[model samples]
Target: MKIRVLIADDEQTFRETFSRVLMEEGFEVTEACDGLQAIDAIRKDPYDVVILDIQMPGADGIKVLRETMSLRPDTRVIMVTAFGTVEMAVEAIKLGASEYVMKPIIFDDVILKIQQQWRYRQLQQENTELKTQLDGQFNIDSIIGEAQSMKHVFETIYKVSGTKSNVLVTGESGTGKEMVARAIHTTSPASSSRFIAINCGAIPEGLIESELFGHLKGSFTGAHVDKKGLFQAAENGTLFLDEIGHMPLSCQVKLLRAVEEREIWPVGSTQPIEINLRLIAATNKRLLEEIKEERFREDLYYRLNVVGIHLPPLRERREDIPKLIHFFMTKYNSEMGKECVHINEDAMQVLINYEWRGNIRELQNVIERAIIFAEGDTIKVSDIGIFNAAAIKNDNDEYDLHNAMRNYERQYIIHVLDKCDGNKSLAAKSLGVGLSSLYRKIDELEINGNRKVTNLA
Candidate 1:
């Protein structure tokens, strides 16, 4: 879309010439004779840039600027003034005029100012979009679970989000401990600020102190410049420490002091830096066990565990499998640009009965892979690749060879069909079978009939 411009001035020659120049430069231009006409034009339509003269009949530029601010505050208004009334132009800026241009207005300079304002507006729009995406991703609604355990977790998050106490989240590796921490931060009073996270296990023991508490110039071998720590970076927001059990015993002492005193002493800095931020820590290791083994400090554990939240593994909450599957399917469908709408009944049953030792993270990966390989709107048992003999055992715990062979045949036929893009003739050619036989097998195996097939010469 072309940039829309409105030129309001008492001089007809100046207004006509400016409008023509802007139009020639690929802008959509409108003209107003005076301040009253400018206000009327603004009320009728919104413009990307407005150029108004300070002195005009019927009304002044200041009144027009106020009206524009009240009606369309986003419109970038540039006040045009002569040498005598430059002070009034300055006053106009305080009243919300975006810029002021001295008369005889150099059209190129005015265009440059308009371009700068346009760029600013574009940046504002991009920032708004990014913030919206972040809010949608981390909000409570984005966390999918309907089980009682998950409901309890949500309740705890809501209760503790309003407080300033430190939170300790305990769970298995893939149970989404970090996700819950983000939900807490997103809903907390400090949501408008940052959320800084660091993995204690990933950082080297020698550098963990400097990484958390910062370092002054020449404090260490590589400390050539002043560095800010996670605590200071997360001021007024949230600092999430993942795998806190891996923090060294020496660093834990300083961390305890920082948490208790609400301050940190940077390396080589004598003065302590006062900090205020909510602390959330997560760990898969049992801190109580670590404490018994003398690896984790008991006092520090208690301090960080003022509020506790535990996420159950996927196997423990089998009832939520269907919801989680559907959620993941929708997410991957949009991301991968596929039309997978649902998981077939047999596929869902296998997923629910199987042991998800890796928890939600593993489930998410499986679903993403299934969506990518699935040939139709419906996800089939073969698409998920869970048809092993051990998984398809009889009630008596015996391997069912007959059922296993049937499943293998089904999976192979689907694979061939997918490779052929649902072209049954080509699939039969690839499988060394007649088209009629392939159709009969498809019927016998109960393959999805809705799969789109294209015929090519």
Candidate 2:
């Protein structure tokens, strides 16, 4: 990442000289003549380092430093003073000045100091990323969900991942079954290793065996070079076979043998190679019915289904619709560089009430497409086609039993909070909630980002 620095000094000579020296060190520098100017710069763009003069008009370096620290503590501030008073500089340091620089700063020394600060910032960022990943124990429990049917699905993944047994994740097409596999691998002891995924249904049957197992040189028509299969590549890791229901019966036997023996035989190779892998498979079809109809193997099905995790369709998780919409809006806003913030109440109601037959995946695609075409800062009713007035009213008027009436307004508020990425104050203001009550209500609603369901070592 580039080093972004802000230089705030009243001395034109000092600002020009310091700016040139820092730029020579390959930092992106923004210059400000006073504390007020510095604050304006900070407000406009995020900076990694701020070199502030101790004395300035409108706002002093101390106030700018304090405000900057509160807004973005990650930013480092280096105090610069022409007439260095040791006591004043010491107080500034205590107030959050990263370090103090005196007048007549050597150009060489200037580069060295900025480089050190930049390195320190990088190390801190890396530590934070690692810590977040480490402390996050992924599990279905962590997903922000509140539907009874979805709750049962999450519980199933939990029970299954705890055991070393095989898991068969059954769900309709577009349901997040692959995510379930990832949660399992991340929580398991094999987390540090690779999590290799393959779509058994998508791979051609002729190439399926070689793809799962290794292939020696000259083993087949295109076998000019030897290659390690996904199983070996994911040694001691996870191998998620998606659409296992579509796997050929012949291929199923080889997969079954590989799972049972914990080894594999390369194509046209006699020797079998041992593998340390965990198996998690997913399918959209009922294997038992397929087995009864002689389209699937009962023995294979039994082996794969030691523990079953059946993800209910999206329509079943109606409570999560508002959550998903806001999540997608945030995603689109960041990607499209749009300042788009909240979703309209009336428009959100359209999404909640719609029958999402295609499930979460479809909903995500719809939201992405809608946001890309959105015209305003806040997502308007007309931006997405879901809020068509006539169609929306018809659906509302036709439903005889409005008994399952949704808390549309409440849901919208919760969704906005999530969209702000869990920033309580920002979420509160966006949702029109008072700062003091926002957190209270978030806890009341139990609306925290759910940690992904994963296995623990």
lDDT of 2 at 304: 87
Give a tens-digit lDDT track for model 2, residues 92-111: 88987789888777767767
Off by over 4 Å in 1: 33-46, 55-60, 63-73, 91-96, 389-457
Residue 398 CA displacement from its true place in model 2, Å: 7.3
Worst 10 residues of 2 by lDDT: 448-457
The best candidate by lDDT is 1
In model 1, what is the error at residue 381, expressed in angstroms? 1.4
Write the residue-wise lDDT of candidate 1 on 1-457 in tens digits: 9888899999999999999999999999999998899999999999988999999998899999999999998889999999899999999999999889999889999999988888777787789899989888888889888899999999999999999899999999899999999999999999999999999999999899999999999998999999999999999999999999999999999999999999999999999999999999999999999999999999999999999999999888989888888888888988988888866555776678767778999889989998988876777666887556434423443456776677667767776675676689998999999999999999998876445321110
Quick one: best TM-score, which candidate?
1
Each candidate's lDDT (Cα)?
A: 0.88, 0.76
Residue 356, model 1: Cα distance from true site in angstroms? 1.7
Off by over 4 Å in 2: 1-142, 387-457
